[model samples]
Target chain A: MGSNDLQKQAPNIVVWVLLLALPLWLPYVGGYMELGSRVVVLALAAMALNFLLGYTGVLSFGHAAYFGLGAYGAGMTIRYLVPSTGVGLLVGTLVGAVAGAIIGPMIIRLRGVYFAMVTIAFAQVFYFIAFRWNSVTGGDDGLTGWTRLPIHLGFTTIDILHNPVAFYFLVLAVFAVAVGVMAWLLRSPFGRTLIAIRENERRARFLGIPVDQHIWISWTISCAVVSVAGALYALLNNFVDPRALYWTQSGDFVIMAVLGGMRSFWGPLIGAAIFVVLQDYLSSQTENWMSFVGLFFVLVVMFFPRGILGIIRRKVAS
Target chain B: MTQVVLFNVFNGLIVGAFYALMALGLSLIMNLSGVINFAHGGFLAIGGYLAFTLMPYVGFWGGLVLAPILTAVLGLIVERVLVRRLYGRDPLYSLLLTFGLAFMFEDGTRFIWGAQSLPYQVPGWLLSPLSSDYFFLTGYRLFMVVIVALAVAGLFYILNRTRLGMRIRAGTLDLETVSVLGVNVRVLRNMNFGLGIYLAGLAGVLAVGQLGLQPTIGSSLIMPSFVAIIVGGLGSLPGTLLGGLLIGVASGVTTVFFPSATEAVMYVMMAAVLLVRPRGLLGEEGRF
Candidate 1:
């Protein structure tokens, strides 16, 4: 058991090292700072989704609603209400978390595909709002004319707006805090209950755990974190649109989590990284990139449903 | 004021019928097989596009009969080659597979037919309103409703009376029992899938005459179909049909007072249904 623990820690350490040194090494490998930042932001969203999907075993295909809310919240705050980036993030996260909590009750009783189907259907409400409420949401053209402000500390100011490297670190720092909290929670008793529920709901229910409540809590946490990622996505692009909340975007996030291997903690992050880079390359290469992306989904489900990390873990176990 | 309300409500009923048409097909596949066919909208698009290609050669009526058949044939092949493997596995794999297929279908249609929306011409006589006072009552709209009504009646007749329909109904109720009775479960699922796809194709042919043809035409209608199934009740075709119309009328009414919320109304209805009746308006208990 001690040896196994050490082995797990070793890979985690290597992963951290790679992530930490990404911005410094990325430019040398033909990757820009913004690309690195995009990956971190998207990976954070995927990881957040995996908390509910991979860990709690709740399948939510409409996470993009909260994610879009976060983006719109942050963007709207920065554009209309407040000019501070920190406040934008706070408001964005709050909006997403609150919405998830409110919507939780309606979907908690549903399990498996029904839950997913309802979630996807509900997400369209937000998409329509964003698309139709043009006066406030800027309609289908997307929210524009707003840019992320530079961070102002007590002693120093970080020009994240101008400096791509600074923005990458800022995203990485938030990712670290959010991912750390999730990892810590997973090791706690409450987290164990979640895992139990995921493994077998009936057994967990028999063990006197309140299954629905745990799932609701897990779902809210996942949404909150994904919203934070959404806020970051808006900050990175300095724009938010109805497309951000579209059902297709939700599918993309699911593919990221599945492609990364839902069982492993860092799997979604890796999945996000590969997906982002591949999508970037594909869009640049062909007009029919959507088909290729769709093909990727088919191929992944058919051949690598276990994901990259899953296959690696299997090899090691063998 | 009455005329405006009547116009939207009447419009809503027509739209609702279209939703019912699509939802019935989706519900059939989801009921018999545990897989939710996310690519259903894609098949609808294929149906519409196929009709468009064939119309120039076979005329509008000929294309109407043949296009859905072609779409169902394609659907049968897909069920056999791709979807069949995932039936015994987790529902997630099938959803993902179909989601991918949907993207392929949409992109494929866009690749074949230009992304620009194509005009589908109906007969000139059907283009004009039946009466001046009820100018909203175009001959085309009436024809579509009549055709849909006939198709739905045909579907129910087949389901209640025909051998294949009985097998499908039995499979949906208890596949294990049907298999125990020496029914080939694989062939049953494949045929059921083809039947559902056939409905989608029919919807495509009917819909394009009114809404026109575009790669995204099917996608726009799909969420409402899901809502329809949910609102009507899971595992109940009558419920799906009812749910589609209810939301359609709901949206149409809302359009009079709150035009912006035309699309959002159905989601609101879905939420209310889930809250008041989680099983749905007509859904069976323990089906989900």
Candidate 2:
């Protein structure tokens, strides 16, 4: 990230301490932190999307396809070939990037609803492949009976997944580092190009920016980053379903993106937290919980067009 | 083989009528306002539930008529308050706004009607029109086809010939010019939005006799509506009908042969269409 951005982040570095320390207090906090861990991972993914969408005007409706694919890559790897979390992660990201590359060529041709529709279509295609290609992907029931790696340095073994605290710390570390990278990217000249692309593609094209390529690269990296969240979600949930790859999953991601206020990275994080909390709270109370949730969505989209965090930040800045 | 083909073709036409009923309003709205009414299916779902509620008093026929009326009124309010604000905003805002409205309407109906699919019976006249050894067809579907055909013809006549049709065409071509010509643009817009929504509601009413109305049907229907529009070409009325018919027939035929591929059929069709013609089968340049 740029020096100015780094300086700006310095004041918020206490958040890093809190996130890292959550694992230490996990023995006390327990289930809450586990959910918190999942939320943070999703938030990180949404943050990446906000970078592409809010900053660059590229709204990806099929992002969950990449996410589910990455999760499948990790889970499938552990189930069959390699068992290292790090390698699984690398492999998952590679699969995501590869998928993004394949999808990217046609995506730049669409903008607005057309682009969104194409993403939805691609996500559905991926989901169908995952479902219909039953022998390889395990189909509807999903690939289960997989194992998580035990952390060891060739001397002693500690089952990382067994200890929620260790897993929490791992997620926090990864999330923080990813966010840091995103912060840096946003401050770079390339980030300016993304912003310029978002504001006016015609102008950027006039200014000699490889506009389509910029969109292509931004979308690809966005998918790659979001894939990390997918992998983590699978690891956290201990299972993956075609549902994870469904267009509805993409809808949820869009909801979180809009709810968090897409203007900033932290907005998505906060939005993700609120979304998870509300989901848990509402579902626990009533089966008709979607009604409340739907109303909440309507109110948010209508009254607070900038989203919850956007309103708060506006107030603070003013 | 002929029987199977004929059966599938008849089935496709029956279902195509429903698709036409669902998509025609969306095409009309997109024509008048430069906005895509993503909530089209949600209104359909509302009509289904509203029909379900009116079953005891209105009977199926009366309920069918009432649903569209109520929905059109709802459409007017929505256009006046919500959609009008988005006149000059980015199309994304319209997409998201309509999406949000769809969610609210669907879930609100669910809150009142519950999430379970409500049971519905076809009216007596249409319930037992035909039963045969090789083929059995629900008379209600045929009835829906006839009803939708009438609606389509009526809409086509109005849009192509009426005095109001000229204004709508003018507005679609350039709303600013129509406004400058001293037309009551706001009233026309509200009427247009209401008219479009009425069609969606009417489609929903007709649909209840064929399929049970559930909480999530709106989400299910939205994609196909999109596929129809995309294939037919956005904002093109005739295109919407053709697109709807092609998709309905194709997907229905595919389902008979390959049941498992039914869900992915629309996307497959869309992809193939894009490969052959990126502007859709009937889409013109600069429509987006």
Candidate 3:
């Protein structure tokens, strides 16, 4: 029984170990601290998306809206309202969550492709706001001049700015908390109810589960977690732009979830890691990296639909 | 003030016509195949670029006629090779596949045509205003409206009159029933996709005449098409058309009152429609 339990825990252990030690080993493997931070931030976003997409069987192609809102929220809060990092992160998460909650009721009734279409369209509203609101959003130039401030804990001060390693740790710590909460939620009874809906909504509805409400909750939770990742992303770059909320960015998040194996908890993280690394390498190698990245998406959809971890799991099971 | 409003309203009509053209194509493909074709815009860009490339050989009129046909052919090949495999699977796969294709198309166009916006030469006679009094009514603008009206009429005629169109409508309503009654479902879907892409191509060619040629042209125009589909109504082609024209005019009018809200007014209208009527203005029951 202990051995069986250890087997189940093996992947989790390896994932945490690698993530905690990313800054240590990344430099030796031709990777920088900023890249490690990017991978973690994106992975968090992908995992948050998978919460709704994989577990709840809801496909939101407009998650970039929430992600962007969180980014703009954090950046704006820091730049205009307050200079504190904690406040920025809090405001960012709340803004995205509140927006998701409001939008959820209107869209929860839609299923499949219609839901996707509405979400994508709704995201454009925010994009245009950021694009046209020149004074506030900085328009096409993006919101600049605000840097993530150092945390002021009672005992100590961690200077996230001017220290790449420190910033990476801050990103990792936030990632850990967000991922931990998601993991906890997925293991709860509420999570099982979500899975039931994903597997067969009609049956879950027949069982009196209130399917739409469950989906609404799931969608909001997913948006909130993704916003947390978005806040971290703003802090990492210290710059936020409308591009962060673009539909293509949403597509990137979706691809990460699918490429890593959406069904598994750790799948999107693996997917994000591979995608971030590949994108970094490709952009450096050629100007036509968009084509290569697009080609990668095609290859994954056609051949690797079950994702990398999915293949491994099947092989091991067999 | 009146002149400004009238000019914008006229401008809105032109933009709306483009949206309707693009939306109609998108609606046709979506109704039949269940694929969103995020690459629809990419195909539109291809249509424009193709016309641009062919102009040197075929002249402006020849390019206009040939480019859309050529674009339709490419669409047929793409549907067969890439989009056909994922028909019965989750719609997500197809959406992603096309999303990837959109990226490729944008990059490919930039690579071939250079990222800088290129000049597309229209006939010199069409560039002149029809009259000094209605100076905004350039011959080209009027010409575009006539072409769009003719294309729309032709589309309706085909849908109502032709056997292929009858088969397409039947397939959209119930593919399994249509197949059981001896229609080749695959062929019907393939042809319908080609028809849709043909429209997108046509929109592309006309769009370049107004907006100029750029790789990013398709992406910029696609959102309005989506809004048109949503506002007009799903599963109703006429609704798509009305939705397009309405939003176009609405935005155009908004420009006179609040310029920044020009792009935003349509979205506001869409949200209002969705709030009041979730299925949209002319959307049928249970389509969502």
The docking category that best describes candidate 2 is: acceptable
DockQ of each: 0.88, 0.44, 0.83
**Model 2 local distance difference test score:** 0.79
Score each candidate by Cα lDDT: 0.93, 0.79, 0.94
- Number of clashing pairs per prediction, in order: 1, 1, 0
Error of model 2, residue B65, in angstroms: 1.6
Off by over 4 Å in 3: none
RMSD to native for every prediction? 1.2, 2.9, 1.0
lDDT of 1 by residue, B108-155 (tens): 999999899999988899999989988899999999889889989988
TM-score comparison, 1 vs 2, better candidate? 1
Interface RMSD for each of the candidates: 0.6, 2.5, 0.8
| Residue A106, model 3: Cα distance from true site in angstroms | 1.2
Predictions ranked by lDDT, top down?
3, 1, 2
